[model samples]
Target: MEELINSAKALNAKKLVVLCRLEPGCLGPDGIDHIDAFCQVAERALVNFNADICHWCLAPRLDKSLIEIQYSLAGKVLSRDKAIKFISSFEQDLDVIEERFEDKLTQLINQYIARKR
Candidate 1:
């Protein structure tokens, strides 16, 4: 998750956001345009497979924390290795998780931009 978010940030995710149920269930995180590409890359990295995020970024029974990570990492991936390493030892690296959460932050920025537009 950290790796993906860092990549998105590096890629210039102006507004990263997640589309999910308030409780987090069948619903999942999704980006409009840029976020999609960013997650596509991130998800691919994690599981080592090509998937259809648009068709099904959501899982039937995934935990909310997973959703949080997905939603939190969209357009803020600064570096792959950095994120992977950080996510690898999440409990020990609070800074990394906080930094990765920028994806959600990016979403906030997008909301403001949409309003402006």
Candidate 2:
């Protein structure tokens, strides 16, 4: 998490978004209720970072074989995609997700900096 914060700082980003995959049945019997609790814990842990922190939980649709993503920043939903399909193994999928996320974050930071100028 510190590494992520440092990366955001290096990019001059005022906001930091963390993405994590929520595997099916990993949340125990409580299921959806645990998500809120987890988010609260995360918020507390990240409060000292001095940047707008957004955590997104990604879940895969087993039946449809697609990824569902929903993320919000400053109480506004920024992006939600339900049709993301991964055709590679688990490790490769993670690499792809990381690359895609880094690219998007770079673009967003660049746009924000341009707007400020």
Candidate 3:
């Protein structure tokens, strides 16, 4: 994840967005939420870089089902309500998982930039 962030930084990106697929049936540090576990790993990954402009969206299920979308900014986790709003804007009925992921991520990145304004 840090390498990806570094690559984005090298490309002169203003912000970085990461969408993760949580492991199925796994438990997190929070004991029940895999997103929380994913967030911990993400935060640790960002420790070597300036994570202030990074946004993360964690999918509880596989990238296909996308049961939940959890957001983190600058290593700080946002409330599910707030995350839900961001996630909702990008939700659409697209069956192809790869294409849907690419499109949704693009939209989220755009939304992240717009929010900075």
Predicted structure with the largest lDDT when compared to the true one? 3
The segments of candidate 1 whose C-alpha lies over 4 angstroms from its true place after superposition are 1-92
Give me candidate 3's TM-score against the actual structure: 0.25
Top candidate by TM-score:
2
Candidate 3's error at 46, in angstroms? 2.8
Model 3 Cα lDDT, one tens digit per residue, 12-113: 343334456555444423324444554455445444332343344454554555535444444455664554454445562213433555565455444433
Q: Note each model's CA RMSD in angstroms.
A: 13.5, 16.0, 14.3
Model 1 vs truth, CA RMSD: 13.5
Better of 1 and 2 by lDDT: 2
Compared with the true structure, what per-residue lDDT tens digits does model 2 show for residues 1-104? 99998886655332324344443333445445454444344445444432323333333333334344444434344443311222132223434555665565
TM-score of each: 0.21, 0.27, 0.25
Q: CA lDDT of each candidate?
A: 0.37, 0.41, 0.46
Clashing pairs in 2: none
lDDT of 1 by residue, 1-117 (tens): 999989855653332223232222112233232343344433433231111121113222234453333333444433445544544553344344445434544464455345434
